[model samples]
Target chain A: MLDVIKSVLAAFFGVQSEANRQRDFQAASPWMFIVVGIALAAVFVLIVAGVAWLAAQ
Target chain B: MKRFALTGICFLLLAALMAGSTYAASINTSTGWNMPPGVTDVSREVYSLHMTIFWICVAISVVVFGAMFWSLFAYRKSKGAKSAHFHENTTVEVIWTAIPLVILIVMAVPATATLKKMYDTSNAEIDILVTGYQWRWRYEYLGEDVSFFSNMSTPRDQIQGLEEKGDNYLVEVDEPMVVPLGKKVRILLTANDVIHAWWVPDLAVKKDAIPGFINESWFLVNEPGIYRGQCAELCGRDHGFMPIEVKAVPQEEYDAWLASRRDAAVAEAAGADREWTMDELMERGAGVYNTYCAACHQPEGQGLPPVFPALAGVGMSVDPEQRAEHIAMVAYGKTGTAMPAFGDTLSPAEVASVITYERNAWGNDTGDMVQPSEIRDLLGK
Candidate 1:
């Protein structure tokens, strides 16, 4: 589980290690990676909206 | 080593030649490669926002590329460097991700604030209706009897390499839209035909004049000077010709100019019915043709055929037998055709001169001198 989280975080930064990526592919389900990717994208959009809202206030 | 030295010398000579050509080319980089911080508070804020983002991008690229280049050069295989077996670093990944998010938020916060300020077109002192036509701009000052059509005043001779071009050239117009300085001028933009954008770079205001939709933009000019702009959107063939010029003046002076303009308009309207001689009609017609007719029908009347027919030696206007048809085409316009009706857009005198000019000028030599009364009779006005 820790490895899965670390791999996702590495992917988010666009600097994932090949060894970590291969390990994640072997140990984790593809569904898990897809869900995490979508969640991270949503968080990014939400952060921008929240920041803009706060600044507007 | 000797061959490399000769090649380097050759490269240096080529570089010097290229630099000499660059010096010959006149590139006006007086204000650097960025938008100007205009003479207004909002414009200044926008400039600050632009500079802030630019610097942030520059800083990020420097650090990112610096690390990459440093690593590539320092740990090259030629230098007997070995690859590391590291998989991932939790701390480094977190730092990179968090830093970018924070930087984005920092940029967005100020940009959102500036945008909101720009969008607040509420308490404007002056309201003006700016309507975009196919190739001209019409300005109607709300709550004032002040309205006029602004058209390109560039002569065909200059455009066709027959005469020397002026400094303003296509950037100049017959009438400039004037506003009072230090006042928020609310411009409600709409298009009579296709979509066109009204943009003034110095003012940092660009809004679409869309058909059947009113878009609003406001600008407060602190300085008293002329600001020129163009139809930023591609409306049609003559889109490049439709230039905008706004003169911001003191309130008292603006009022005086307004009064004088209204008086002049009234005088022009009264004089519309007067008779014009061959010389007068020919001169007026040339201007009218250049302004209205020249875009589709070429300046020399050698039009783009298979679409726009030539009016120089050909067309029904050149023939005396088809004179009524020519007048009808000008007054009512052709149905299902690009030729727009000028009956309402132009005064009777204007129509008369344009018709007279098309016939006599451009080697047609019909020598037809027409009166406004004749055009008025044709229009049944």
Candidate 2:
């Protein structure tokens, strides 16, 4: 489970390799990657929001 | 190790930047890094659009690079971090692609609308025919007999470091293309000789002036001021010399100027037939030569040597027999050379005056008076 999260995090930074991709695909279920992807995207939006808020100040 | 060093260096730089300067430099000032939302609706829109994209890119870089640096610093080998190897899944790929799609959709909507408005040149109140020559511009107002060739008015002395340069140097012209404020002016662009692009960033109008083809663009002036631009293409040797100056004025003033311009044209036509004195011929010829010929032969009649023959006292035109040949050369520009034929371009009187000026001004005293009638005969008019 931790491996899935780390792999998804690396992919979020857009530096994932084919080997990591194959490992993630061969995992028991696909739900872990989806959940982590959404989580990372949400983090992205939140970072954008926080920076925008600070800039507005 | 490399990534660790990069993140460390980035943080150090950021720290130095934040701690170093209380005087934060601003972008996009009059002489700075930003576009002026000029005093026109279209230009304002362009500026807004440009700023929106600029900020968006800035925001993106900040977020992406911030997260990257954070991860790099936190996951360094020195920090006892071990590399984890895991790759992409189908669901994550789809979401990543879709997120970018959403952002693009948001941007494309307004961008398309602005582009469509810019392309629509319909229902303009005035039409100005802008023809680009080799290194000059000719503006002819449609449905008006007011037309003139605009040339670079900056003297060569300043350009060659012989005199002090003025504030508006190189950007000034003998005649400016005048238009009225709050009126949509459609510019029909074409080229007389080669391809040139008329570009004025403040007005947000740029179109190619291509030979044998017409391109169209339009702009409505919202304020009264002088806006300048240049031929934004490589046309010839003197491409940098040609500049476009647009003077926007109130409607009433524009009408008065138009009337005066028409009157001036009539007065010039009347004077064409008037018998001119040696002094008058010399003066008029100087003006004509400086406009057309001086670029090659030079202002002082001392041509640029072998390429452009010297017309000074001791040059070929000083000889009695070469006088007729000089007239023919000016009238029918020598082929296989850079000398442009002015027979079709210059009026009969203009050709006569210029020849008279050249022969007399430099004291190349053949004392030869070639009448306008003589030039007309050679032109077979």
What is the CA-based DockQ of model 2? 0.10
What is the per-residue lDDT of model 2 for residues B184-253, given as tens digits with 9 covering 90 to 100? 9999999977899998878988789999999999999989999988999898878999999999999999
* Backbone clashes (count) for model 2: 4
Error of 2 at B270 (Å): 1.9
Kindly report, for each predicted structure in the order presented, the TM-score of its chain A compared with the true chain A.
0.71, 0.76
Candidate 1 docking quality: incorrect, acceptable, medium or high: acceptable
Per-residue alpha-carbon lDDT of candidate 1 for residues B85-188, written as tens digits (9 for 90 to 100) = 97578578768778998999899878988899888899999999999988999999999888889998777688779999997888888899999999999999
- List ranges where model 1 is wrong by over 4 Å: A1-57, B1-32, B85-91, B154-165, B335-337, B363-370, B374-381
RMSD of each: 6.3, 9.9
Measured as a fraction from 0 to 1, the native contacts recovered by model 2 come to 0.18
**Candidate with best lDDT:** 1
Error of 2 at A4 (Å): 30
Residue B63 shift from truth in candidate 1, angstroms: 1.0
